[model samples]
Target: MTQPVHPPKPRPGDRVAVLSPSSGLPGLLPLPFELGLARLREDFGLVPVEYPTTRRMGSSPRERARDIHAAFADPGVTAVIASIGGDDQITVLPHLDRELIRANPKPFFGYSDNTALHCYLWNTGIVSYHGGSVMVELGRPGAMAPLTADSLRAALFTSGPYELRAADRFRVVDRDWADPATFEAEPETDPGDGWLWHGPERVVEGRSWGGNLSVLSWLLMADREISQDLSAYDGGVLLLETDEELPSAEEVFRILRAMGERGLLERFDALLMGRAKTWSFDRPGDHAERARYARDQREAVLRALAVYAPDVMAVFDVDLGHTDPQLIVPYGGLVRVDGPARRITVTY
Candidate 1:
């Protein structure tokens, strides 16, 4: 197994490249994108430099690859941040120059469809962050979540162990970024109930792997960007979460079952299941319905663990995915899951 490299950290005044590796939603809806860029400048004290195809819709895979290459090759650009995630980043991965990225490793921050890039970094032996997209979490309506800002700040500038905390409150629904009124105040949020731990009493510390489950599944099917020897993941902490698509509990079980059947489920010593995104613009579930959805999904995960990885430590409702106050997780980096003490920590 290749040991991943931690990229050089960026200081407050450094330039961070903001590119849309997937969709160029910034061009379509500029409010959140502009807000995110402003936060990067004023709040974080870092300048954001946009790439050629960053805001251009229908950018080709090769064009996106050129942007990535440009950002990583530039000596002045200290880091790279995805504007948001979309469906076609898988195509962009093949066009990346592995040697160039390896020669100049810098932190890359994103999640969701950006899983494609995360896996690419993992294969190239460079650790990349799996949360904190510019358009979504950082550019959140009103102000950015305190927990998110804290996590991003730590991940961006430091290189050490950071304890993960559950958000006291979280939000799921998206507000219309095109509307001027949406930026007037903070989006609505609900109380967070903390994490649910399962299995025997123990702490498991290892390199972190995995991301959005659906994205992982797609990678598995495409046979791209994964290690040839599955044992590379052995004893690692598997971080998994679902997006707003809201797959059914049974579907979740089936995916886990497939992983188990492939002998992939037993490799992880612990699992960090991000809080499920229960509500979306299309579904618009009520409070009671959302609660039920989360409950059923949790149960599904437990059932899968019982069958495939009975001894593996598992934690549910982690604030790391499609939820507000999202905590950034380091992909292919160190993570400590303490089941007995009910705490989690990641090396940022």
Candidate 2:
């Protein structure tokens, strides 16, 4: 197995590359993208540089791959972040030049479909961040969520053990990004119920792996990044989250069951499940429906673990992935899960 190496951290005044490895949402929704760029400058005190395809909606996979190479190879660029996520980022994976990226390792931040790149970076022996899309977190209306900003700041500029905390308030329901008013006020939030831990009460520390559950399934099918060796993931921490699509509980179980059947599920000593995103613009539901959806997802996960990894310590509803106020999970970096004290810490 390749040991993961942490890339050089970006200083506050350094220039960070904003590339569109997936969807060029910035071209479609300039409001949020502009807002996000501004915050990167005024709040974080860092300059953001955009590539040719950063806002080009119909850019080809080769174009996106070129942007990635330029960003990493440039001596002035200190980091790279995705503008937003789309469905077919997997297409960009094959075009990437592994040697270019491995030779010039910079802190890369993204999530959702960007999981494709995160997995690629992990395979190249580089640790990349699994959360913090500019459009979603940095451009949030009113102000950046305090928790999100603090967590991102730590990950971008520091190299130390940072503890992850359960959010006191969070939002899974999103407002329409097309409306200008969505950027004028903050979205409504609900009280957090805290993280739910299952299995034996013990401590587990390992490198973090995994990303958006649906995307991971796609990678598994393509046989990309993942090692064929069953013991490659032994003792590693697994990170799983659902997107805004709100897939059925049965679908989630089937994906995990496939992993279990392949002798892959039992390799992890711990698992961290992101809070299920229960609402979408197309399927806006009432409070009751949202509550039931979350409950069902949790049950499905527990059922799968019972058969494949009953001894694994699992934490559910962690404020990561698609949820509002997301925390950055270090892909291939150290993660510590303490069951007895109910504490989680991530090394960035």
- The TM-score leader among the candidates is 2
The sequence of per-residue lDDT tens digits that candidate 1 reaches over residues 1-348 is: 757899999999999999999999999989999999999999999999998899999999999999999999999999999999988898898899999999999999999999989999998899999899888888998899999999999999998999999888888677788998999999988888888888887989999888988888888888888777889999999999998899999999998998888788899999999999998888989889999999999999999989999988888999987888899999999999887788899999
Candidate 2: lDDT of 256? Answer: 95
Reference-based lDDT, each prediction: 0.91, 0.92
What digit string (tens of lDDT, one per residue) describes model 2 on residues 5-93?
79999898999999999999899999889999999999999999999999999999999999999999999999999888998889999
Ten residues in a row with the worst lDDT in model 1? Answer: 168-177
* Model 2: residue 310 alpha-carbon error in angstroms: 1.0
TM-score list, all predictions: 0.98, 0.99
Angstrom error at residue 244, model 1: 1.0
Question: Lowest summed-lDDT stretch of 10 residues in model 2?
Answer: 224-233
Off by over 4 Å in 1: none
Give the per-residue Cα lDDT of candidate 2 at 187: 86
